[model samples]
Target: MNAENEDFVRRRQLQVQRELEDATRDEVVVEPETGRLPVCIESALPSKCIVSFDAHESEVNALCWSPSGRLLASGGGDRKVKLWTVLRGQHQCMGQYLGSNRAINSVTFDDEENLVLAADNDMASRVWGVSDFRLKRS
Candidate 1:
């Protein structure tokens, strides 16, 4: 119809196309060689395991998933708890919570996903606020 109306329609169509593309895109797109999308991630629930990788220097003893499933917390024999961001079968360590005297044995996310609790072999348990990873006492 009018030029201004035609321009508005064109812009709307482009915007919709972009939204669709983003919706279907692989969530984790890192340097091609740095990450790989596993079959399990691509398929919601695969009956078999397809990919596996080492996420810690030593054996991983505990794991906790954020409420949203986008973040993963893992405690290992290295005496550290690592926070990982998982997407599209790719897991990247985003941060680390250290200070445990011994290897961490258990890790869990709080109900609100705002805190993480971890226990170490030294008979110490600590709580870390998810946002700043600060030691919390109360």
Candidate 2:
């Protein structure tokens, strides 16, 4: 190869090596104190896992997890609230209830775990029997 081509290749190789070294290097800073022995610490660990669930067609306004942590309920701008089940580490939409004409703002499960209370911007609140998802009238 020509000398000019060889020089270009060597420069590119050096640049790549420098980048790799910088990427793998640990960046840390320590402050000195007068009364105590110095201590060394590594940087905080990064998050290892993330789970994202997209069950609502519109903006999600609220969410509640079941007492067992095996299920989730989500209320959204679509004026609906949905219940989801976590099976084998994946979230599955189990049921949906259209409770109001306007956006549902909040949701919570009752003490017995058999009732769900939902409030919406429609100036109404609803209580639903969790077993059959039937509306409970006051």
Tell me the TM-score of each prediction against the true structure: 0.62, 0.61
Per residue, candidate 2 scores C-alpha lDDT tens digits across 1-138 of 699998998999999877767754766555466445435454343455546877778999989987777668889998888988877667788788765788889988876678778899978998887778788842
List residue ranges in candidate 1 displaced over 4 A: 1-46
lDDT of model 2 at position 73: 83
- Candidate 2, RMSD to the unseen true structure: 15.0
Report residue 122 deviation for candidate 1 (angstroms): 0.7
Give the alpha carbon lDDT tens digit for every residue of 70-121 in model 1: 7899999998888988777777887888788899999999889889899999
**Candidate 1 Cα lDDT to native:** 0.82
How accurate locally is residue 42 in candidate 1, as Cα lDDT from 0 to 100? 40
List the global CA lDDT of all models: 0.82, 0.78
Worst 10 residues of 1 by lDDT: 38-47
Q: Lowest summed lDDT over 10 consecutive residues: which window, candidate 2?
A: 37-46
